[model samples]
Target: MKQVPPEYYQKLEELQAIDFVIVELTLYLDTHPKDQDAVQQYNQFVHHRKKLKKEFEKLFGPLTNFGYSYSDYPWNWKDAPWPWQV
Candidate 1:
């Protein structure tokens, strides 16, 4: 297993936190559809998540296998070290 930079791990951590928040907010919104404040917050987080994901993809590689984050050169997604391996 190869080592990844600290910044890469930090970004993944941030993205994971964002994803957790999104899921929690989704569950809350499902039960309380009339909560405008929660809905606004959810939308804001969604936007933030997208921005972070793009930055992550640009710096590291695609988080998913079939997204638009595919690289043109050496296919970093497949070649980069997996999280568990590091």
Candidate 2:
């Protein structure tokens, strides 16, 4: 199996954290969509997720082009090693 670099793992961990925040916010926002506090928190999660995803892509490869990496960047997400590969 291919080995993932320490930097990759670091970014992966951050991505996971952001994902968890997103999930939590999703549940919270379901009943509080109009709550400014929830909305701000949700926006913060999205912003952090984008940063983490960009770091992940730069260290490894893009997971999604939505805001991570540009299509012209070779789009190697499918070929990159998984987080737990080695």
Candidate 3:
């Protein structure tokens, strides 16, 4: 199996963290929609997630369609042994 690039792993890790933040903020936003602090934090998490997603796509491939890539890159999401496959 090919090793994942360090940059790709780093970006993935960052993205995962951002994902959690987004989830948490989502819950917070549900009841605290008027809270400026939560809204600001949620927006910042979105920015970080977007940046990490771009970095991941650039280093590896597209994980989604939200401004990740312009060209039709190889879709490896399904052609895998899953993350733990050897």
Candidate 4:
């Protein structure tokens, strides 16, 4: 497997963690949509997720595929050491 920097794991873990929270909060909001505090927290986490995603993509490469993320002329999605391979 190709070697990746330590920061890659750190940032990827952070992104995964925030993403997980967003999912949980989304489920919560679905049941308790009237909770303003939960709504606010959910929005905050979404924003943070976006920022972290950008940082990760800029440093590493596209972390997702399809419409969620863009690829340059020469796609890098198939690059060595996919997230799982790391």
Candidate 3 lDDT over residue span 30-65, tens digit each: 998999999999999898777767666555655755
Poorest lDDT segment (10 consecutive residues) of candidate 4: 73-82
What's the TM-score of every candidate structure?
0.85, 0.75, 0.72, 0.89
Over 1-86, each residue of candidate 4 has an lDDT whose tens digit, in order, gives 66789999999899889989999999999999999999999999999999998888878888887689766658877663567777
Task: Report residue 22 deviation for candidate 3 (angstroms).
Answer: 0.6
Better of 3 and 4 by TM-score: 4
Span of ten consecutive residues with least summed lDDT in model 3: 77-86
Model 2 reaches what TM-score against the true structure?
Answer: 0.75
Best by lDDT: 4
Error of 2 at 22 (Å): 0.9
Root-mean-square deviation (CA) per prediction: 1.7, 2.9, 3.7, 1.3
Q: Please, what are the lDDT tens digits per residue for candidate 1 over residues 1-86?
A: 55679999999999889999999999999999999999999999999999998888777667766564667576566766655655
Model 2: number of clashes? 0
Which candidate wins on TM-score?
4
TM-score of 3: 0.72
* Candidate that beats the other on TM-score, 1 or 3, i.e. the better one: 1
